[model samples]
Target: MRPVDFEYTSPTSIEEVVRSLADGGGEATIMGGGQSLMPVLRMRMADPDLLVDLRRVPELKQVREEGDHLVIGAMTTHHTVAHDPLVAAHAGVLGQAAASVGDPQIRYRGTIGGSLAHADPAGDIAPAVLALDGAIEISGPAGARTVPAAEFFHGPFTTALDEGEVVTAVRVPKHTGWGMHYEKFAQVAQSWCIVAVAAAVQVEDGAVARARLGMANMGQTPLRAEAAEAALRGAPLQQGALHDAAARAGEGTSPAVDAAGTAEYRRHLAGVLAGRAVTAAAGVGG
Candidate 1:
């Protein structure tokens, strides 16, 4: 399949990108690494009049530490994030999840901003970002503003980004000493996860002080397992305690029945994977 003819422009500045989007009258699509959009375009899922490319924007490719957060530029590649020392030290969950995205080629070509903006429920990175309580910075004709990661996704393949708006960076709180793990179940290597859980635990004096749980492919959007998280808090850092908390993993989720598995199967996987992820993070078991 071939995409329809469209005008393309590679802009070095955000202002120019916004101007191009504005000129296209809401019919423009922004291209970061193009790992996701290229497939969508070739399949004719979207037909935009203009394509605003951000690959030339130097400012969007930087990863820096600001205050208490590690700020990752929107155009930063997954490969860079996976191997970056700053990211590994500050946000290990993100680095672990980024390292598991697709394959080496996809990781080299895919961008964090692109993955979050695409808002796929099965994407590995978004779940880890959600568990880390990340935020996204958006720039548009109106100005710049921030959106929390929890509120960024609207539905599968949809987000809160409006016309003329571009994601400039993602800000994640540094979990310097916390234990983190991303557990995924896929049919084959390099395949999308059928069910995955991202867990970050802060253990204190042999007790779980704080726990964050994010589920992938559990609903229309990546969701936080609030019930499970609440149950884990103050619990002992043991396998039995973690298993009990993970039992409620699918309490509020709405998984879909698909070729990967049935809804019931996914719900079961959620609890099983949550136990594994949380236990691994807490160092309760291998």
Candidate 2:
């Protein structure tokens, strides 16, 4: 079904968007690349009275580095994120995840900020951002604020974004020289992840100095494998130690039961993929 009739405005400035949203009084929806929202609209899943498009806002389409963080604009497309040299250099895991977001068409139109705001548990970007210790920038009538990726996701399809607030950018700390990989398991190509792992490893003298692991489709939200990350610290760069650390990936988590697989099966895949992700990221022989 087609979306219901709605007022639409393509604002060129954030202030105009914010003011329009305020006037909408909780009946407005921000449109980024619209790759995700259009489907929702057509299905009648959501029907906002006003649609505020951000495409005309040049400020929201940039990719730049500030101090020690890489700030990616909210409207930046997945295709750009996947191929941008700066993203590849500073946040390889995020870039890798962007590359795996969908087929070429979806990647060309989907935006990272839109994906994070949609907050799909199986989405590739959120877990990668969480593993990178990134932050989400927000703007609204109340002014702007930043929320860390860990605190940004509240539940599946839910986030810390208040009504009328738009995600302006995503700030990720630079991780130069770090080994990174995004491991995903899907029923078919371009399908959502059944279970996926985002691994970033820092090695020092043949030992794991630091490790960050985030798993998708294993809980209410994308979750960090704290147990596994803790165990990997100071562990030798060997398959045995890596497997031991990876085995803890499923600890203290409850995944959902769905057509994709059972919760138990998802948990099992988490552990197995954790091992593969960490091994490849840390440069250990598979």
Candidate 3:
């Protein structure tokens, strides 16, 4: 299948890209790595009149630290994230999650912004971002705004970004002393996750101070396991506490039934995997 005929423009600057999209008036699609968009284009599932390529926008490809957060350019590749020493030191959870995104080739080309903007519920980064409490920085005709991870995702393949906005960067807070883990179940090495969980635990005096749980494919979006987080707060960072929290993993999830697994199966796996992730984060089973 071939994509419908479209006009292609490679912009050299973020401002140019924004102008292109603004003029396109919702009929344009930005292509970064196109790991996700290309397939949709080929299948005719999407047929935008304009394809704005961000490849020439080099400013969107940087990774640096700003005060207390690691500011990652949206166009940074998954492979880059996986291998970056700074990412490993401060946000190992993202590094671990990025390494599991796809095979080597895909990782080499897939961009973080592309992955997040694609908004696939089964995408690896969505859950990781949720767990990390990252924020997305967007620029549009009206100027710039920041959208928190919790509010950025609206539903499967959807987001809070305005029509002409470009996602310029993602800000991940440095979690130097926080414990984190990412656990995913997939059919094969390069396949999408069946039920994935990313957990971050902040411990103090042998007790849980803060816990964040992000679950993939449990609903319309990469969902926060709020119940699980609530259950773990102030609890001893032990096996029993982790297990109890895991049991509440899917408390508010309304997962869809599909070939990957039935809702019941996913709900079950959610608890099991959440327990594993939380335990790992807390060093309970290490």
Candidate 4:
């Protein structure tokens, strides 16, 4: 299978990319790293008249601290994100999730912005960003705007990105001293997640003082396990409590039944993995 003939332009600046997208009317799509877009092109699932490549945009490759948040450029590779010391020291849970994506080659080429914009329910990065309460930075002809991670995903493969808008970076507030964990069950290391759990926990007075939970493949979008997070507050970091809380991880999720497994099976896996993730993040069982 081959893609339809399309004009391509690699813009070295965000402004140039924006101008190109505007000129293409709604027929052009931005390409970041191309890990996701290339496959779709090969399968002919997408046919854009123009492909605006953002790889040459220098601003989209910077990773740095902004105030109390870590601002990672949209074009930053998973490899760089997984190893960035700033990420490790501040939002370690995000780094843990980035490290778990696909394998070596894909990680080297895949990007956080691309993954978020791809809006795949099973993507590893979105759930971690949700758990970390991060925000998405978007740029358009209207200038820039920030959307909280909680409001980013609208549905499966759908995000809140407006037409002509591009995700410029991901901003995560510093959660230093918080223990973090990411757990997912896949058929193999490189396969999509059947279900995944990302947890960030803060302990005080020998109990879970605060908790944030994010679930993937358990709903139409990457979701925050609000019920489970509520249940964990002031809860002892014990197996029974953690298990009880984790069981609610799928309380309001709507996972689809597919060849991978039934929706019920995915719900079950969410709880099981959430337990492991939260327990580990809480520093309880080994």
Candidate 5:
């Protein structure tokens, strides 16, 4: 399917991109890797007057360490994030999640910024980012600002971005020695996750000191399993403790029923996956 006629502009600088979006008002769409936007365009889901391309902005394609966080440029591809040694060392859960997105070709073209901006409830990266408590950097006509991952997604296919704002980078605090895992359940190898869990656990003296759990496709937005986290704090790293914590995984979730499964089924998967993910991160067996 061919998309409607639209003006396209590739800007070399973040400032230029902001100006282009501001000029187009709300009739402009920002194009990152085009992995998600192209499909939307082909389906006529979005008919913007202009397409502001960010490919020419080199600064948006870098990965570096800054202070306590590892900053990843929005244009960094999933393949790069999945393979970069720096990312693997600092945020292994993010790398594992990126490796699970789509197939090889999709990972080669999909951008981290693009996935976060698209805010798909089933996207693999969102849950990992949410679990890591990452932050998103944005640039716009007004200026630059940061939004925490928890506050970034408003709902499925929705975000906190305002008109003329483009995501420039993502910042995640270094978790050099933490145990992390991304657990996903899908119908096929490259299909969207029916339910996914991202877990990061910090152990102390054979006990679960801190745990972060993020759920994918469990709600309108990627959600943190706060109740599960509370239940696991200071608990022994054992099968019983993991199951007890995971039982509360669906406490505050509102999952949707679709062709993949019913709401009840997803809620059940949430608990089961959470237990597996947490135990795996903690290096405990059931």
Candidate 6:
């Protein structure tokens, strides 16, 4: 099934892309690396009348630091992030997650903004971003606005992006003293994760100072296990506390049944992987 007829526009500027999308309104879709959107179009899952290509927009291709956050342009490819020393030093969680997205070819072409905008619950970056409390910056006719990572994802393949808006960049908080771990359960390297966990923990004197845990493929969106987080707060970073917290990892989760894993299996995995992630972040796991 080929895509329906559509008008293509390669906007050289972010402003041009925003205006084109505004002009076409709901009939338009932004194209980044086309790793996800192309498949959506080919299968007729999405049939936008206009394709606003963002390849020419230089604003969407930067990686820099601002204040306490690392600002990454929406068009920066996964390959770049996975290999960049700056990203590794500042946000190793994202770098680790980016290296696991799809395969080498996909990583080379797939953009972080595209993956976040696509909003697949199984996608790697969403959970990592959620764990990091990242922020997304968007541009539209109304001007620019920043959205918290928790509010960015609304549901499966759904986001807070309104019509005519484009994600310009993502701001990941600087991981100065946090220990990070990204643990994924997949049958193969390129397969989607059945259950994955991204954990960021700040430990001091063998106690958990702060913990943010994000689990993927556990619900409608990348879900942060509030129960698990609550359990870990101010607790001793020991095996007993980690196991106790892991039990609550899937407390409020209702994962979808798919070929990858049953809901029950995924729920069980949430517990297992959450333990692994937290343990790893606490520097207790290999």
The TM-scores of all predictions, comma-separated, are 0.98, 0.98, 0.96, 0.97, 0.97, 0.95
- lDDT by residue (tens digit), candidate 1, 175-264: 989999989999999999999899999999999999998899999999999999999999997799888898788887899998899988
Q: For model 6, where is the 10-residue window of minimal lDDT?
A: 239-248
lDDT of candidate 2 vs native? 0.93
Candidate 3 lDDT over 51-141, as tens digits, reads: 9999899989998999999999899999999899988888888888999998999999999999998898998987888888999999998
User: How would you encode candidate 6's per-residue C-alpha lDDT over 129-169 as one tens digit per residue?
Assistant: 88888999999989999999999999998999987899999
Between candidates 1 and 4, the one scoring higher on lDDT is 1
Off by over 4 Å in 1: none
Error of 5 at 121 (Å): 0.7
Misplaced by over 4 Å in model 6 are none
Instruction: Give the alpha-carbon lDDT of every model.
Output: 0.92, 0.93, 0.90, 0.92, 0.93, 0.89
lDDT of 4 by residue, 135-250 (tens): 99999889999999999999888998988889999999899999999998999878899999999999999889999999888888999988899988999878888888877888
Q: RMSD of each candidate?
A: 1.0, 0.9, 1.3, 1.0, 1.1, 1.5
Q: Between which residue pairs do clashes occur in model 4?
A: none
Candidate with more favorable, higher TM-score: 3 or 6? 3
Candidate 2 has a TM-score of 0.98
Span of ten consecutive residues with least summed lDDT in model 1? 244-253
Candidate 3 scores a C-alpha RMSD against the true structure in Å of 1.3
